[model samples]
Target: MGIAGESVAVVGAGIGGLSLAYQLKKQGKPVTVFEAAAEAGGKIKTLHLDGFELDLGPVSCAETATLKQLLADLHLEQEVIAAKSAVSKRYIFSGGTIHAIEPSPLKLLMHPMLSWSGRLGLLRDVFIKPEAEQTHSDETVAQFVRRHFGEEAHQKLFNPVLNGIYAGDSEALSISSTLAMVKTLAGTYGSVIKGLRAEKGKLNMSRKIIGIKGGFIRVVEALQEELGADLHLATAVKKITPSENGVKLSLHTNEGEQERFFDKVYLALPSYACADLLADIDAQMASALKQIRYPKVWQIYCEAETSDQVFDGFGFLVPAMERKSLLGAICITNLFPDKAPAGKTLFALFCGGDRPYAFEPSVEQAVKEFHSILKPSLLKVLHVQEWSEAIPQFYVGHKKLLQSLKAWEARYPAIFFAGNYVSGVSLGDCVEYGLKINSEKGSVEVR
Candidate 1:
């Protein structure tokens, strides 16, 4: 398919938008990307302070095949760096203590994190049959885990782990939206454990977590270099109007307000922002987009005064049931030695999720609360950052919202949606979805 006269406008310069622009450009399509921020790589911010390299957003990326191919295509394979094996030694906080998450199955069976009964409950998953209704219906992650593994497993094992990833309440998050692959496994095999056992050899369980040597910002820089004049910075799209053959975008630039028309427009923004852009085009579509919710998150980067190491492993997640002020914490220096100078320990503390501490706090208040909860010996705060609407929470009815989005795209063929909110949240998910765009058809099919 050839797109000779057709032109595309991508809003937002996040990974999704940049990757989509790159893919569309490769297909010989005329493309332009508009970014409100001066720099690209939204939510993938990197900083250098106190002689330590810090990543405030995503710390690492899973070495998925799609990501690997993307790096290869960009000739960035040599820049890739793998985290230390010690990063795999994760931990969980429970009962006022941190317990190491053992990787060995035998050691995990006797792991102190769970009681003996809870350990046995995991083994019973192999024999437990998936509920017929649950296989077809959308349910909370807490409900699915409790039914299959038992309450102890749900509380002790899954809750904190899920919180570390989603920063969401297990009782409210939809399994079908967050862990759709796992849900499919259970629904297909009638047992999640059985499904895992059957696909043991086929699964890529040993994939390494990786990052660029310098920072993820290099990715956007590379894309921008290729885009050249096609990339606009510090330009915001104020309004969008649909036309018979294309769309009209009103932009707010440094000079003045301007209007431009495009054959197609791809919104790679947050659901709420997309809602605002499409409000005039279709009230129903805008209403559906408004239904999506995004949670606020505070990520604090701190350097410990003591040279002595903290608990080894990736980090520990605090279960909401524990009623702790912290959502989780990651030992950045422990994961990648190059992140900080030798004899210096750096940690990234995360708070504010679906729990009571969801509101943003002053730097002093956040430091005080963090000290009270973590009790790190003589902690020195390096950076305190907050993302007001950071991660999108895939609530109980997220799947229904996705279906509605699909219908909206069918009705409005020239306006397409692509973002972490529409697909999975991982960088790999966004990149893969971007690569799958059919520029000739002016449509994006997000599976």
Candidate 2:
């Protein structure tokens, strides 16, 4: 059946679902969003305490054209605020010392981040060629980094930086899927250095990171306001039955067992949840979905007694070779002053990606580990304001897995799987992809 004036049901109220709902509503389409959580934003959570705002999920985002266009369409262009341009200054632990790297290539040669011998070792990357062919293979991210840039780059550069972004394990993560763009660049120029320079405009063109004026939650709030009653909170979808023309979803809401029919249905829930929901629909798809693994990460927020001795710039990343359990830390206070009290600095500490066992530790133990690792210049005692899970692991065979998923989407022509687990993990990427999927040609039985 064709989908024109058909009803659409969106499961999950995360950025993807919210953005999709916003786009569908704009088109005057009857779209209803069902969220298991009481609030929207899904993983994009923000916490406020004593005039301080802590973004529990993604703290900042790049100023990409995709994000800019989305903001403009949502009438949120004016809400974008550029963080400190100097915030790009990064520190990495190498040979037992923290050193800052110059943001430019010329300064990179002069930068003390790596030894002369290590810099020479990096030259090998300029001459190395791609595999010259594409084959379906499962390789870890660390393996790819090591093969391309040597061990030092893997431990010191790639591990910490990638960890700070994804809260992921470099060794277990899939290189082809997570770093697809890097592979393309290397294949094109035959040198990452040359390719990065040529493709600078597209990759990090603006090179400036921006955040919402208030926080990421503001986007969710605005999206919810437009949705009004169509957005149902605490509504968990139980079962989905395929029909001749559409599909019927059995939802377990607070009221009672309600059956809703829609011509199109978007399953934007997490991988684990999505797998469970589609178990009976297609067993093979469910099995493949279950194979998608997720990492368990904990975010620790701390406040210094006085800002006088606090660290400057964004924060620092601890290399894996350092044998330190600490992944990295982001200075939230430095990024946004409005997020903390006047006299204190806020630190976003990340832990427990490879070490999920640490998640069972008591808060006191976690804080002890954090203070021992961070050892900020501040002498005053710090307190942990929050510690929560913010982990998402993308293991090997992810891209092929997503392709398999899209193939599975073919089985249920009208039921679409749209979520961070299937595509890009970034908030903007997920949301944008969700809206894009809605605009695609498809129809499934939902009644």
Candidate 3:
């Protein structure tokens, strides 16, 4: 036993699960992680194909202090490959032209594509106040943005960024679950910017986009290596039975099906998997988990010969209002030049999730559009990876589901749901939340 003679079991070996298990072990807790898949990374996998490296899952992470500290603790600080300056230059396709977002305040004011009204609306947000007695209650993202930044900023700026990240409609996604930081700022200081100012003084909350040197697969490997034999790849937790003493897991492995008892169980599984495993324990819990939605998404990988026509930037995002087959695209070479061959650039175009319909033709159209923008002497569409169930959508009422999870955790001792569906979906979010949840449980100390 690693901590106080307690045997801990973590189900699902994705980043969330792995990070949780890794931290528990670091804190002297004996933990075993079980994954249904043969590999441990989940979506954050790198595919080496055709002399190019492709990141199928999350392309980059927001290098928050939490993540930075974690990486340093894991001895992976030197492995971080900071994005090139181009990463800040994200393009947005609007009105038939791709415009780069200006970072400088002065430059942004004079940005030809940025509507003066949009900038004014954003400035107005600083002086704006919420409705009388407004609380941090559940509200749609669109509503929150529209109320604060006005329709122009919501459409041109906020919505396009959300399109690239969430793929779901801002009108449906919950502000509390999706943009909790800004929401808290608005609720506390009456303005997001004001809240940011107040919080930044209190803590070092700066963050940036980053990727591992080899790929996120390198991250998976590092985590897996750190876990060592404690991580049971291809071992599945078929069922979970919570008892008075602790919790029991019905495990299915290559050898045979066997039952194991643990002092506590942390489930870092997908909502769907959690639904199936918890059906017997509590139908209400399973029903709530099943209600969470994961729409289909497709990632199209293509390579092109470098040319003047090719833009040197992080690529473009098509606002949901634009009706483009492409939700967004990332220029792999710009971020990490080491991932591709010399004189060649790689592009990853995304489509489908939350889109009305995503088919081959749609993907083809996206490729054609990028082919035009990224004019190359030679263009080759290398691979198309389709994730049937991609990012989880946190709807307006997701708060209730979170509250229900909290309630269930309280009712059942030594049982916790620690999955993406329960918190923000970013890699940093999962890692930070995993640590915070367990830390609050009086198991491990959190800094």
Candidate 4:
């Protein structure tokens, strides 16, 4: 499967695109990546202000083997660094208070996040036979959760945390696709607690849940350097056309319209962007791609250091039932001590996802709203130093929409789709999927 004279064009220089490029280039394929933005890394952008490290998108990567293999292949194992404090634990906001998410099953049973009734509800999952339809249905997460767990679990437990990830309402997100891991756990062990205990032996402990030593974008920079001149920044792909020989692309650059042909094309763009390009190539696929939904969120980063303040732990997630305008608050300082200067903490705030009623105001509005959430507890002077232009959204119906997109790929052998919008939203998952797409043939299917 040497690409030799065959050239592969990657549409976006995000993790997915870079991973594909790296894998293909390794396999003797002539690979070229086109980035619409002035720089690569896509949503994984990092900004430094007043000596504070701000991650506009992802804060950390999960401890997984897929990431280890990917990074090891790129020789970035040494670059990985864990959080400074062992208190790098997630906090869940429930009943107007925050509680650390206990890691162990015994602690989880004692955890205050779930009420006695909720705990009982969790036990029911062990005896409850998984619905036959649920095993393979393409339904929203809300449906599966409400059916299996109950409304309280759906509202209090899954919604907020998932909203933080997808930034879309779980009610509309595909259950089988978005939460495949959970489904696997349920189907296999019939209980999350049992699953963790049984599968712990198969896990690799070396890959810790952390970010890069410098910043997440450092990984992107390293990938760019590895790819060398093969990476093209500030090149926007306008459209992709399927030809009898291969695939033709129309691109927009400062120099003007450019046409390029490739033996294969990997679209690492957003679902909507993919729809736009596929419209001329495959109308049915474009229709299904257009159905994919994405919500919008506004991320605001504030740099505030106070020797007097005592906010501990990684971050806090807000449940929709709380009626708070903020989705959650991450004490970036606790996650990475060096993220901010000494005595100062970096507070990252997220807002606007799933709930339309949630206010999405200016930096002033978001900062002011968050002040109310933190002020009562910390009672400190907080000031926002920076803000992002916009946040991404992974909407409902994304799974079925992907099915249609892949079907189009089946029809067009040389065309493929890979991105956060397609299979996953995590940096690790995106990278893995990109490499998988390159290695596999026929149709692009995620299962």
The TM-score values for the models, in the order shown, are 0.92, 0.88, 0.90, 0.87
Stronger candidate by TM-score (3 vs 4): 3
Backbone N/Cα/C clashes per model: 0, 11, 1, 2
Candidate 1, which segments miss by more than 4 Å at Cα?
A: 103-109, 120-124, 130-136, 305-310, 356-376
State which candidate, 2 or 3, has the greater TM-score.
3
lDDT of 2 by residue, 1-447 (tens): 345577988999988888877777877778999998788988888777667777877888776666677788778988887887558667766665567765564566556776786566566667765553233255787776676667666776778867776767687777766777776776676667777888887875455688786789988888888899999999999888988777899998888899989987888888878888888887887887777666556677777543234466577777555545566777776777767778677777766555323334344554555565455555232334332334456778676777777666677666887777764777767766745653556421111
Highest TM-score model number: 1
Q: Which candidate do you rate higher for TM-score, 1 or 4?
A: 1
* Residue 209's lDDT in candidate 2: 80
Residue range 104-204, candidate 3, lDDT tens digits: 44465566766888767676567767653175477888888877777776777777777788878777788887777778778877777766766777744
Q: What is the full ranking by TM-score, best candidate first?
A: 1, 3, 2, 4
Q: For candidate 2, what is the total of clashing residue pairs?
A: 11
lDDT of each: 0.80, 0.71, 0.79, 0.70
Task: Give the deviation of candidate 1 from the true structure as CA RMSD.
Answer: 2.5
lDDT of 3: 0.79
Q: Model 1 lDDT vs. the true structure?
A: 0.80
Cα lDDT tens digits for candidate 4, 162-253 = 76776656766666667776667667766655665778888443355787766788878878998999998988998887888788889899
Candidate 3 contains a number of clashing pairs equal to 1
lDDT of model 2 at position 328: 72
The alpha-carbon lDDT assigned to residue 259 of candidate 2 equals 93
